[model samples]
Target: MEEVIENPDRIEIEVTDVTNVIKPFKFTKDTSKSSLTILNQSIENIDIHEIWNNTTLHICADGGANRLYEYGGDKRSEFIPDFIVGDLDSITDEVKDYYKKQGTKIIPQLSQYASDFMKSMSLILLYFNGVEIVDVDEYDGLSKLMNQLNDKHLVNINSYILNGLGGRFDQSIHSINQIHILNQQYPTLKNVFINEQDIVFMIPKGRNLIGYNSISDFYKGNKFPVIGLLPFSPCIISSWGLKWDVRNWKSSMNGKVSSSNGIVSTNGVIIECDEDLVVNIER
Candidate 1:
């Protein structure tokens, strides 16, 4: 992960087109629920309040509900989650009741096979796909619920998951693993993990435009937003709009993995790859 190649040729990718499509949703300060955001239990003093306000459907994963309740404090009433999901083990009775009274749908999935994070993901797919479970209280409702989504039409939604990283090391790895698996199961859904310091997402195979309208639009004051092009599996990658640009760069877990790279593009960054790659940018 530490080796570096100097003066590699930049690959040609359409960054401007990709930026045009995702710019409004990613950069806008407008207060409208245009996407989905999930909160995990490791919530801290995150400054991305605008993301919370702009998310239409917010779901908390069990103890994630607890963290959100505690973080909101005086403004607790203002940040009620749309759905509080997972096994009822981590959520406190008081916090549960508070959100329940506020009309939040509390879903309890008792299956130990999948983690609370995965359970919440299933709930998101079910809700977005318009598949309502009549036996919503079933211990493993999400298990069967996901099956029903096969016949239903699902709209592609961008998911911003918070507190998924910066926890236990194994959990962070698992979260990244789930990101890859989820993309395979549900190809349309784009999942992004948001930690306190970085924003991470999977770059799909072929060309991907990591676009932005302006530098300030994504990172207000940072002249060079630090980034990394990580390879969980073997892949051939090439890039543009970066300080250390690479062409046909072979990357893998045991080989050269691009880390501590910086974005140099005024507008956006473009990456072309033969397989899916994980990308992280400092926020």
Candidate 2:
């Protein structure tokens, strides 16, 4: 599989709306902000406070609550999570009591089948389906509510997850696996992993017009943000507005993996692909 540099003859296509997926990066206030989830990892160099202020819903995956508590320090009271969920493994009693007093819903998900991250996502899914967050007493309730709805499409709520990446190799791979599985099962549930240097998410299979609020600012600062169109499997792709744009290029893990690609357009980049791609926008 080789890159097709020449695409003088190509038909125009419709652009998918992915602006909402990248709204968190814009630093603009919105009536409907994305939800935030904290994982069990050190949030070094990440501004957790700014993200907390922008999110509508918040969840801490077990020990993640402890991380949040320690990170908040004296201002811990101001940074309460909406929900703390897990098998009661890592979350300390004092930390739990603190949040419990602040009216944080403590959910005990016992089944080890899904990780705390997945369980947290289950809560998000339940909430998006119009199910009251309080009614979900435990992990089983999550499945019960899910069965009641039996709907493929849940509310399209954008989610920003912190500390999900750059951890243990297996765990990081698990997080990425969850993102792929979540997108396949619930296409509307847009989950983005926000790390120190990148925002990772799945770009759907179709023509997509990817953009940022202040792309020209990056250019002005002489920092054209790097990007990638990583394929989970073999697929054909074409792109515009990138420094190394490709046309009808065949892509896959075995060959033609696109990475370290730069964004050159001041407006946005239009990527057309036959399969869903895992894209990482370098900060």
Candidate 3:
């Protein structure tokens, strides 16, 4: 995809509203849709209050239950997870008992082939599809049921994962790989990886309008949001409405890349690429 202008040579542009990061709890543009997944790591500065209140479904990935358990402090009682899905390894006895007693479904998926993050995603899909989480098998139950359904019939899920990236080198790479895999196999599953600094996601092939309404509407800060366009695989790219928008440019890890780019458009930015790109925008 190239331009917004109607031309037989260009691919039609798609609009992705990313206003939920700032206004997740409040209804905006006549809709409120998002899901929260907590990975096993430190979530020291994440806005647990806002995200917990806004997201439609919440799940903790094994040890992540412990992070959520401590982050909530006195408010732990108020923000109970809907389900805890993993290999039953990292979650402590105390934290496990806490959420289980709170009526949260504890699904033990003992599959070394799939990471707990993948298990969490499949669990969310099964949950929204109305599958009984407890009744499924433990070894690879989530994937089993998820494969039975067609992609067209699966629900579109906007997932925000806390502590997903910036962990140990291998796990972080696995998280990145999972992002790309989701785009290839489950295109409807829009997943974002978040820490204290970055809101990371995959920008697919063709044109993508990134942002909702105006920048001021969501962010009232003085600085423009810093962003990057990273190509895991070499690709040709073009763009509009960025501080340094490229045209017919080649982006690759071995060649030119777009990093430390700032969003300048008040409305939104347009990105066109021949291949999928990993994007990380400052929140």
Candidate 4:
């Protein structure tokens, strides 16, 4: 059999489109004391509503639905997830009933083999492929559906995952592992993990040109945004469009890991890598 390389075109990722999710805060000389207190204690400000609005498809992982509900508060009615998927472990009955009444697809997979995050990912695959009639009650339903498809049948979609990182220590590591595996299995699938502080995704090997309308599109208010070109494992990288650009730079955990590097590109950064590198940009 002859070898086949799918999607040989240069991958272009735009982290700027979703930057509006983080609202910029501005204070005036006439600002009231109570308004300042509200601004300081606004936990709701970090919510994923803006990201949710920006994405074409939104799937919540198990307890993630509950988090969305609480975050939305009185405006919970305004935002409804397209699909709620998991082992049905953390989602409460009240939360489940709430979305169920609103016609949200609540899928419960009782399999211990796959995490809630993976289950949601499978649903995303099925959604984009237009795979109708998925057995929501079946254990490992999404996994089984995915197993039935070949590489040519698997299409790429820009997926934004909320609440996948910055949780419990072990789970957070698992989230990163899942992101890496997903990239390998589906090269075209653009998976982005929206962490509380930064947005993380993989930069595929080759010369990647990331373009945006302006530098402020990805990093608003800040003149320069902090970014990292992290090799989850050992890898050599060369880059451009940064304050401290390096040519053919070697990187690893024990060696040099580019962290807190400033983005000097008025628009975007370009990187060519020997291996897939984890790219994290401060939001």
Candidate 5:
């Protein structure tokens, strides 16, 4: 059965760990829901304010806190992350104390087993649940809070927006992995990763119409955002909508792949496929 609930405050999406899954999505003004901006080490200072203004939640991963603290300077108050989380390895004492004094919660999850990115995600989930952080060092305390909320079915999540992608090749790939992992593991959370230029999201399997006010809405008339029908998984796939649109195009890491494709139509674009695929829009 399909379920739809009224949540004017957020957008919910499901993603998978497999690469090259093409699900359909439409970029509309109404689709602009709550944002979750993640600042990694690769982030730049120029767009910090813009991202901060557009997002409802701000998060800094391990070293991301240091970047924010340094780049945020006098404008630091304007872009304070609601929560600063990680293993506390790269986070400096001065940065931690500074944000804490500014009323930001510093969560230190020393579990080397889990990635700092994963811990940050847990904090985001907690924030959406409206749970105050009285302690960060209790044994499995955050996990216990999550479990209790799950038991009572009181977990509420907003659309998550991420920044700082396409920098380090491995970390960028890891970010994409989280995209698929969250979709499969926590199918209720909505996510978007914003890079230095474009916005990235997943399209689930089936027919999807990507409507926009204009192609220029995302790109500024230079050209349609660069798109790709990436097949990172073992499964072969095909795609449509490109200067060289494919018909029954079987794609995989080892087979024919679509990359560096541009939007040609003036009105909008349409992408249809049997599996989920990743879409990139150059900003």
Candidate 6:
């Protein structure tokens, strides 16, 4: 008997086209606030300098160090991550050495159960809270660290800019899971996952204004940016304030997916939803 392997290229193409339908509301760059930037697999269209200067901390999740090292040059001083964390598997020895020499804290978590992305997230929590990374005996100890950070009233995360999604399917979904988990656990933390052509994030359950100063805030000077209001989770959702607005529309994997919707309004857009949903903006 022969085993059949599914072609990932086909799946990626399908999702890319499916996700590109929504038209986005844009905003100008502030260039002053803080952001934690993650260099994952795909980081082509991002303005590394803009994100680096505005963000207060930098973190690389495991092999993400490689992407950072490759994409970042003498600009290393500008975007040096405050901490590099992961299971220590995919990260190359050369990349590790380079960051170590630069005085970046390397946390070797030898747990196969937890993914590198999750470990990186844990480190971000610690850094934002101003807590020291105490050595732990097992990866399960991550729960303890979270508890300690919470008990000490030290979890102070505001917003984060994540790079590299739209590459590997599982990793991309994992990133989406982090968005929901972080929002549920730490409502104070705002997460925006950046890819080569788009930025993906979640809208909390309620009203949200997808506002922007000018369309150029995202596209330099192109036409209106693409946007989508997606219902990727298992929940059924109802939404308002869209060009093709839905009234009590039931959304789920087994139901309709709002993948190719567009934004027709000119002065920003608004979306009111009964449940939390995923939103993507074309870069």
Best by TM-score: 1
Compute the lDDT of residue 221 as modeled in candidate 5: 54
Provide the lowest-lDDT 10-residue window in model 3.
Answer: 3-12
lDDT of 4 by residue, 113-222 (tens): 98877777777766776677455556877777776556446665666665456647787788788878988887656676655577777776767755555665655644
Whole-model alpha-carbon lDDT for candidate 6: 0.62
Regions of candidate 2 where Cα sits further than 4 Å from its true position:
1-28, 135-139, 151-153, 216-221
> Cα deviation of 55 in candidate 6 (Å)?
0.4
Could you tell me the lDDT of residue 258 within candidate 2? 83
Q: Give one digit per residue, the lDDT tens place, for model 2 in 193-267.
A: 888888888887887777555565323446577888889889999887777778889999999788987776665
Q: How far is candidate 4 from the true structure (C-alpha RMSD, Å)?
A: 10.7
Q: Give the clash total for candidate 4.
A: 0
Ranking by lDDT: 2, 3, 1, 4, 6, 5
lDDT of each: 0.75, 0.77, 0.76, 0.64, 0.60, 0.62
TM-score of each: 0.89, 0.88, 0.87, 0.81, 0.77, 0.78
| lDDT head-to-head 2 vs 3, winner | 2
Q: Where is model 1 poorest over a 10-residue stretch in terms of lDDT? A: 16-25
Model 4, residue 227: distance off in Å is 0.5
Candidate 3: the clashing residue pairs are: 1-206
On TM-score, who's better, 4 or 6? 4
Clashing pairs in 6: 22-226, 22-227, 22-228, 23-226, 23-227, 24-226, 26-212, 35-55
Cα lDDT tens digits for candidate 3, 1-283: 3222212211223446322222221312323446789999999787777667767888999999999899889988988998899998999999999898999999999989999999998877777766666687889888888765574376666788887887689888889988899888877678877778867888788877675565655455686777799997999987766666677888899998889877677656678788998887776
Off by over 4 Å in 6: 1-33, 74-77, 136-142, 152-156, 233-241
State residue 250's C-alpha deviation in candidate 5, in Å: 1.1
In model 1, how large is the Cα lDDT of residue 79? 88
